[model samples]
Target: MALLETLSVLSGVGGLSFGAYQYYRAKSDEKRKQELNDLADELNDLRRDIDGIVETFQSPTTKVDLSHQLDYCTKDVLAYKHETGDNALVKAEKSNGGEKVSNAGQALDLYKNGDTYPRYHLTLESGYTGYESNLVYAVSDHAVYINHLYKTLDKLQERHKGTLEEFSPGLYDGIEGLMDDFVEDTYTNILSHRDGIKVNPDSHNNIEEMGRFLFFYFWHYEGITKELESLSQLSDKIEEARTTILQASY
Candidate 1:
């Protein structure tokens, strides 16, 4: 009778243990499913935010704003460069008039020898009239602008790297390519124009090209702004996912 009682108790304990194990497994599975659902929701939210940004870019109002920004940046760079020469001239005159009058005058005389009077003395000149002129600044500005746009595209690419595998991978991939193209074209144009600017600052053709390119490049800001909106949406979605995951603990 004692043996029988002992066997019954053991059986009961084993059944309870098995039941507990099943209960825990179900709970864990539920938790995992909730977490996944949360992640999906967050991704969707991110997608919406991104869509909103893109929509804004498409809006005329936003385009106008971008236009203004581009104009300001171009104007600032050009104005700065243009005045650089004048500033240099003024300084040269003042210094020459003072203690180094004789030396300064001699340098001026040497510089004024040709139409390209300051070719050799460009180093001493106040502005970017020499080989290392502010022309480089202009080039760098354009290049940097292009790079800035490219960086946004890069961000999109990074996000899509692992996360978009289950969703619309093809669409995201295409968008990434488009962004890359925009960056590449802008960079190419900048380089081409820079070469032109360096080779002939006074060439009517080159000057016109430079102006056109600058204007066009300014428009890229609009695209970048739009891309940023999309990225923001994606971030929001990610946040939503995290929140959902945390709340699903029970």
Candidate 2:
């Protein structure tokens, strides 16, 4: 009878141990699901930013660069990493266990020491003269935002298992390529004054005297208008991609 009691006590302890392990596993699974959801939500927000970029590019007085200028190489758009780790949107864990938090903006800005910043620096106001009135200023943030989206999508691809599998692979590259081409052309046209054509305000060529040869012709970039028309295609591809990501969980 003593042996029976002892056996019963051992069985009860074993059952409790099993229950504790099950609880831990369930909690762990929940955290994983929450983390996946957070990534999906982040991916969606990045996609949405592109729509706004399309509009901003078309406007005449649109100020696309950061309101304040900095040496963008030292502080590119992704520089938000060193800024904060607190995300107010979603909790870091599945449960309200205050352990670690995440912010999408901060995640994108995770590092500054990279090769990408130099290209980003070229998009600043100094990228081209008269950028404020033309495409350089217009393309600055658009480029950064698109770069963020591109890098974010690459990250999600690595993070996830499976339609969400790079639904539109070339879409990111296409938009980025167009922006790059436009920026390149703008520089070539604007900087022609230095070596190719003399448009500098010199003793020979007065500012008012160059009126007939208006720089407005330079802003009429064939590529910008061409890309503008194709914006619909860009929308369709990304909308489909976002749909796939939205349906995904973990």
Candidate 3:
């Protein structure tokens, strides 16, 4: 009877031990699964970041350059008469009682208007001899193009402000300053000045001012080109970071 009781006790202890082992094994498996799920979520987030960087790089904003053309008025008709001996309005009136002249005063009355304006070329540095005007649309689309790039960078900064700041605080600040400068200094001062000169061609001050401003305008062009190249590098860096994170996680 003692032997039978001893055998029963041993069987009970063995069953309890087997139950504890099974419970621990199941818990371990559950923990491992949770860890794997967490890693997958992290990886997905990194992939999304990568996609965002690529999308920004692909944006039309990045394609902006000096290739586009701006149609802008260069000289006022009456103003041109004072600067140059030739009077375009008088000639037009002589031809047909001013029937072809538009109230807007654009010299190129025949050209369809929609963001295009009369083109003018003047050089005060050499001499205040005369002015030339045309309707041909070519390069110097800097104003609107730079504005688009500035806005694009602004959106990108807002989207990844925290990440960018964490990666490189100075760079983040520099980009912020660049956007502001492009709007306030480059776009506002240079482009606006050009427009002012084009519209007020009769003003001697406006003409003279543009002569001096041309130097700065060309200089700004070089600066903007360099900034764009830097921005391209930044985009590549972001992509590289995303790739590194993914590789490390794997």
TM-score quality measure for candidate 1 = 0.35
**How high is the CA lDDT of each candidate model?**
0.40, 0.43, 0.38
lDDT of 2 by residue, 1-250 (tens): 9999999999999999999999999998787667556656654665565565565455422342432221222132122223332211100011121111132222223312132521221221122233352112112444455556556656655665242444556655565455445445443443332222222222225322232122223233556667655654666666676666556543
The candidate scoring highest on lDDT is 2
For model 1, how does the per-residue alpha-carbon lDDT over 1-250 read when each residue is reduced to its tens digit?
9999999999999999999999999998897676556445544543544454344334423344434433433343444456563322110112111122233233233222212111100012214434453221111222222233334434545543354444444545554444344344333333333222221223324333433344443223435655555555544544554455445543
Can you write out model 3's per-residue Cα lDDT over 1-250, one digit (the tens) per residue? 9999999999999999999999999998776555444433433343343333233223312323311211111233334555665432210011211122232223222222223332222222111334353333222233233333444444545555564444445554664454444333332333333422222334435533432333233224435555555545655554555454344434
Candidate 2 has its poorest 10 consecutive residues by lDDT at 86-95
Q: What is the lDDT of candidate 3?
A: 0.38
For candidate 3, give the lDDT of residue 172: 48
Following a full C-alpha superposition, what root-mean-square deviation does model 2 have from the true structure? 16.7
RMSD of each: 16.0, 16.7, 15.5
Using TM-score, give the best candidate's number.
Answer: 2
Clashing pairs in 2: 78-109
